[model samples]
Target: MRSDTCQHTAIIGAGIAGLACARALDAAGLPATLFDKARGAGGRMSSRRLPDAVLDLGAQFFSVRNATFRRAVEGWHKAGSIAPWPASLWSAQAGRWQRHEDDLERLCGTPSMSAVTRHLAKGLTVKAQTRIERLVGSAGQWQLVDEHGEHHGPFTRVVISAPSPQAHALVAPHDATLAEACEAVIQRPCWAAWALFDAPLPALPGVDDDWQAVRVNDPRLRFVVRNQLKPGRQDQGESLSLLANLEWSEVRLEDSPETIVEALLDAFQQALPDGSRLPEPSALGAHRWRYAQPDVFAGGEAVNLDYRLSASGLSLCGDGWRGPRVEDAWLSGHHLGEALAADAI
Candidate 1:
């Protein structure tokens, strides 16, 4: 039941977007506090560590397209928090493999996907494992209530960087405009499976052993990446991240993790070339992201606006407000933080 009566900005969610917003505010000489239900930051960028494998169950790699994000990426690269990955790519369709090149520079967090968010979260005040279930007060003075019924607030403003559906629930009772905006965005689900093999996978015909990733046009699996091949990762074993197709995952959303792990592993085997056999995995696991990516913008065409700000000191920012890329999430929060610093919200 601890409470704070200070004049601070309360940011709900310590993901990439939320961290970006907090950083922007900090640079502008404003104080903000971040809260997250997870044990650490990174949100979708989080990673899982096993006895011999470090698997990235979400956001395998991110590309830099915009100048702002590019600049940030450069800094991260210099700071050793991120590194380029997947220099070789392959595409698989009906068990046919071919070299795929897109000329896009993709980077992943060093050691694990969560490193980037951890770097962003450094020096910032964060309350981890705190699920803010309710916004209790009104207007200028707001209070946040967690799932344990613990109250923590009296903040000047609140910014929600969670997924669209979760954000909608919090804003519905306060601001209709923000609520409707959140409601208009739909998020898709994804089931990611990780497997650590005792040995390397067999190379496909005409494919080199250095091939690190694959884009599969299969009904069950969509993308697969070799964790050990990625830059800055220790070669504990042949680790693979199997990402299931969106529609396939959505239909089996409630399925148990064991079911998902088995299904995705079977899918990966089917995706291999005709005579190639997959080695027995030493360890396996699965993670379900109920709200993984933005599916559609029900409010007509997708808007280019990076964020949404309300006059009631409530603001919204995330990939749902912009696009699905990690860059979009960062931009959304960064722009909103700037606006708030200028007293625009």
Candidate 2:
């Protein structure tokens, strides 16, 4: 629970977790200041506009499982901002590709994946395009230090929602105990390629008519997505997105985008059925996620919050602790928010 003396809060990382935490604080009559290095909110839950189509180059889609996230999804659905994605999932194993038929309640933002997070960010005090390099405490309140060495702060509490490695860097200078927790967490990288073709692709077996996205066991490419197939996506010439396998992406992290795009497109071609033919793409590009996902660990135990430092007004939460999905991020932030609310924050 948050103390009444705890007034304004500073939240780093404008992704789902930070938004959820800010909303919770605001609900309890506490103000919040959100900070991120990006030009906009929704870290990896972002979308880019191409000449012909909108591409969700980050999070392809999300699924609702636990009640907490399901409740939020219902609100987004009623707001007409989200819908179930009807695309199929394919996984490759031992050279045999099998379709995933679990009938999952997959969800995605209507116009773009960031739409959901953008909706949650309304009415909050957000400092976009500003990166808070570190946190400092003075007198009693907490202060934020930007990369430019400027100071901004005097907040009651601080919540960090960045990736574990980034989070560790921020807190290690202040609290070594908490730094160890953040350092113990590791992450994986991913490389994504977006391409626009001249025409629509033929519908494949075991998938819907709108589009096709598959997970393959290729050397470079992992998942291939037809952007237009999902609900609320742009309808035009084919806009396909390819996600490289994690190991491959890590190995090629330093490669140029043009080089990566060519490799991925070639991998996609090789993944197609024998003798399948398609025209060359009109445009092609790539993006790299250096810390894309948390590396799954063997031990089940991990730190969630360092309340021992809470007396000094600091807390840490992020998807890097549990998972690297939308729901995981939301729940972690949501739980902290509820805790603060219970304390009458």
Candidate 3:
């Protein structure tokens, strides 16, 4: 609202990385506009509001391995946005078992994963449901168009934070090498099922003995989480949320949502004793991620392409160039934001 004439940086995608970029740019005293095609913030770190409870459909949990991420997680914990949960294992080789409590901490967004993204996006300018159809360099500026062919800005710089395939489509015509790099980043699809149960079903054999987390070794079951057992769910008692792994969901991807839900419910019943007594779900849904995870990881390399557009100021950033995960996307965007800010200076 300051009407500052500083270089306008356009960032595509409102996921963790995009929000992080926006926050970083604002802190650096730079003007930026964050665009996302989704209706709201939180791309992969998404949550669904059910009739009974909130469900996390995107990232089940996030662990902090790096100092920077750890510091960020600590801040979130202080803000009541995140909490640590006990870790358990469900490997086919080891069977269902609880790992000894260790100093290591596994964290999850409070209530839902979206809580983390929403917290991070605070005070940021985000334009949702706005798609960037194409990028054209004109007179040293970059023009971004929406699906309707309406152009938004002749931005001083542009950063695309979409998936690799989409990013390749956007930049291939202009920068062949950058497009090639984007294409080189392969992604795998994942399907997931989220169910809300009414009752706290009895524990199953080879499942969580300590009531923490459960990993099912069945080929159909990748990871299973009981919401009530999570760090912040103790107060929410009786309302349990379950997240089924991608392997099972992928096998039933072609099935209708209702069919998939039924199959999952049946599987759940068969896996646990008196599982049939589990509460009838108040809500059931499934999501298909065409590019769920990066096939190969990029290490010590920036997952972004900065192009002068043969004379224009434009750049592209996204998970495809960066490594996978919410953190990777955020770091890449931050890197681009810093680069743009430095160039403006």
All models, RMSD in angstroms: 3.4, 2.8, 4.0
| C-alpha lDDT of candidate 2 relative to the true structure | 0.78
- Predicted structure 2, TM vs. truth: 0.90
Model 1 RMSD in Å is 3.4
Consecutive 10-residue window with the lowest summed lDDT within model 1 = 296-305
Best model number under TM-score = 1
**TM-score, per-candidate, Cα-based:** 0.95, 0.90, 0.83
State the lDDT of candidate 2 residue by residue for 1-345, as single tens digits: 545645778899999888988988887778889999998889889888776788988888898877878988898899887887745676653334466678578888987888998898989988998899877874257889998988888887788888878887888787777688777777889999999888767544444464356787887988888788777765566888899988999899999999999998888777665555556888989999988877752112256441223445676766776676788778777777767656553
Per-residue lDDT value at 7 in model 2: 75
| Tens-digit lDDT string for candidate 1 (28-104) | 77789999999988899999988787889999999988888898889888889998887888898878888898878
| Stretches > 4 Å off in candidate 2 | 1-6, 91-99, 202-209, 297-309, 343-345
What is model 2's C-alpha RMSD? 2.8
Please estimate how well model 1 matches the true structure, expressed as its whole-model Cα lDDT. 0.87
Higher-lDDT candidate of 1 and 3? 1
Global lDDT of model 3: 0.66
